[model samples]
Target: MPLFFLSYSHVPVHRAGRSPDFDRLVFRFFEDLCGHLAAAGGPEGNAAGFVERPGTPAEETLRALADCRVFVPLYAKRYFTDPKCGRHWTAATTGPADTRPAVVPVLWTPYPPAALPRAAQYDLPAMPGDGDEAEEEYAATGLHQMLQLGEELGDGRAGRITAWLARRVLYAAATVPAPPGDRHVPGPLTALDNAFTAPLPAPPTLRITVLAPTEEQLPIGRDESRYGPAAEDWRPYGPALGPLADQVRALARNLGFTPDLVAFDKPRAELRGTAVPDAPWVLVVDPWALENPRVADQVREFDAVRRPWTAVLSVLPEDDPQTKERSERLTRLLHTCFPRFLREGRAGEQNAVRGLPDADVFALWFSELAESARMRYLRYIHSQLSAGGDGTGDRTEGRP
Candidate 1:
């Protein structure tokens, strides 16, 4: 049986996209915590872990809860509202008095302590950056204090938290006499009924669909002699829309929006079925891909959707007379499909020319595209809202 029973809500909370640095930090802490426990010299040390299988039978979850040394609930607003989380909480607290699992609450998100259920209102250790910085600092200090207790407990915030929890589990196992092996099943819990039954809040968002060329449309060429030999010989040599898609997704997240990426190779019928008519789209097109009849036909069908969208036509930095001629011809072909498509301009041109292989340049290009799409989306929302004769309008009808 695991020593620690960790519970957290799986539902994602709506927040304006910021750097995912904090998310990464929390994940690292969990990883380090597990590592610390495994390294701790004891038979039970290796057994120290948490189960997070969602949709498991209630009896199975309760059995796990019953067997644990400590129950660590990562509390947030959503945790209180989720029925499954509530069930877990109930199972931990409602058993025989002697057998009840020791609760360790971690403030994963800021929520009023006073408003929490009476059973969960005890003095508890909280995770960092939820509300109180002082509490986190104290928790960190306590962890470092444990280092003297054992060499396995290393240095760092993650180490400190892990050690602290491990100490708690060990202490509980030693001092708190185990209840009878026979268990009394808990009755249904109603403390969180209001939260569970309440309507969920609508998330604020602007949807953006990204259309990218598939590998077949722009195959990797083995010969690098034609495009001037590089480190690797691959046609359209360089990171494709993958990096650009990541950048777009990050930017959209930051802007309080969600982005959906659609491959160009998908059939037109499939595209239309899933396409959101009101949402703005971004198409990352390769000039060479336009030359293919199949690809051109796909582009034409995509344009027929009649949605507000932006197209980014990629170009190579190296310019010879032959390359320039080919680029010009490609530009003309794209114009037939996307009359106002954005293209890289020369130094003398009004628009700034963006080139691949330069991180800063690519970032700027992505920012511009994202900002433009955001503005267009906002306008679309405003128009819809105005037409509805109310600032708050239901825009989900036509959305995919």
Candidate 2:
């Protein structure tokens, strides 16, 4: 078995006082190391370890050191100056006559090895190259050098310590493990010592669906009724409609709706044939062939997969001289085609550059929508729980 002997800055409780917080951090580092080492060699590769000389007798401590094939020295700012550290370093690193265990030094803090007293610094590996001052130079240089020298010198310090540990500590570093299930566990190491203990990213709340033109060279319409001169010039609305759907989804999110965004782009018949997931709210922007009466069967197909409570934002071009006429025609077409919108929970909404007076108006409206949505969702959840599923009360109708 690959045995690791861990040594760190030690503060005896009677000598100093209570255990400093740094001790916890050092333990966490070793814990993580164990995990990494196990992953590299498999369960059989993992071996028992100790941080300090743990036995009552000096002989017992010596025996533990004898069994240790790898000695991991952890360093920090105080490590160099502490007297106990000096003794521990001598015991761990000083070879007995000719035989010695490989010594791997890991610097937890950024202080330079040069800062260590001459007696303590001697016999260590050469110092790494200098780096930026803003960065903790010693830690970065030392760590990179350590990783480069992996498994060869029998000197414990080399080769991908962080990466190796990552795989070992969290089984299969290929995927991030899900967080703890119940009550939160206090980290073995605090933030001052370890980065791995921080909280993971929250899962995404909104899904975005991006819609773009299906074909590049579809001819401009010949009939004036199809669209005016601008409509004929409307090469493809998809490119212009990129961030607009995000803005609409932001509005929906603020209104207490969960959004799942999907992207559809041009020249792909797959987009035209695809189905949108059933959501409480959906925003379809610049649906490329959606307005063509010939594609009514294709357009209304969204209703087949969606729920009754869906709010659909159907985006079409207002790119003609008669903007109002185009909008009115589009609205009527949506009403006729998507019969789902005529129901109680479903509604048709539209957005255009014209609706926003300026950036200020847009910002204010967006903020208001988000606030209202959160408040509405909160009230709905509260009501659902309180009314025994009847939803009987007015639900925060008049409250200040």
Candidate 3:
């Protein structure tokens, strides 16, 4: 059984939503790592067992750290500089610098090396999202070096480092011997035969309706191979249609729901346009036609025959007031000028992150839409019903 020590800075106090997201991401990563380890033989037929303890100085926390075979640090902007973070860093690196119980550091953001005051051995890359070309180039080189280090550390190094988790960390919680002087050492949940089991929740069915102008405005093309050109096009599909179908398909497999997709097109020449059907959930992409304005004429034609639907506009962040004014104007048009709608814009600078050069900003924007749609749909399905008897339940789902 390998003992891993995980540490990070205290959760930010500003955002209430961020804490849950932060904790969920961390725990999910651990779960994924364990699954990978179970595929290997490291954890004695059982997956890696772990005891997730938050950062604390309690006796229990100390005992676990003393026995930890690996030290993992969650490297963020404030983590290396914070006093609490500094103490953990010192303990992990000192007293046994030569020993390889696997010390790993995972960066939350691309921080500059100059910012690191804790230990000088590690070299951080230039911060991404700074929108500096020279900094980005420097960051890319550092990222490559970090990946190489991770490859070198192998599985034995389960520190907070990105390289530490290059493979996966497995634990045999069942194999953990009871600590000396203790009546019983609590084993992994697997020891009780309940570790890997989760009661399947009955997945509620949710409808995802796309209220786009027409097929011409947002084309749906498939590839010969499941993963050819069509697959590539699908990356940008979220801007038009949210990931409700994909999410419904994935979640319903575990729950229950038949996902229905409706597209507004000039289906019949006799019928002027399509009328919006009563759907529990309706998503309006490009609500204001900000990204592509050429399709605005078609959108107007569709809106001539409108139904009560939630609208969301995607905006481009601009540093200048003029561009910002233009973005706000379009967003306001979709909100007040249209029906129930919300507008969302992203920082243009996010596209210029140094470390993630291979990752395109436009691609990421689409990805965010897809992911947000999936999560929003899940919440919508679980909410109470609306008085209108529209399948919307209590969950009024609309995300920009």
Candidate 3 regions with alpha-carbon error over 4 angstroms? 12-21, 44-57, 96-100, 118-120, 123-400
lDDT of each: 0.48, 0.40, 0.36
Cand. 2 TM to true fold: 0.30
| TM-scores for the candidates | 0.36, 0.30, 0.31
Q: How close is candidate 1 to the true structure, as a TM-score?
A: 0.36
Give per-residue lDDT, candidate 1, residue 156.
49
Off by over 4 Å in 1: 12-31, 42-46, 54-59, 126-155, 184-400
Model 3: how far residue 353 lies from native, Å = 21
What C-alpha lDDT, on a 0 to 100 scale, does residue 212 get in candidate 1?
33
Superior by TM-score: candidate 1 or candidate 2: 1
lDDT of 3 by residue, 134-175 (tens): 233323333323334444765222223322242322221222
Ranking by TM-score: 1, 3, 2
Worst 10 residues of 1 by lDDT: 391-400
Candidate 1 C-alpha lDDT tens digits along 191-251: 3233234443332233433333344434344223322222112223234423445665676
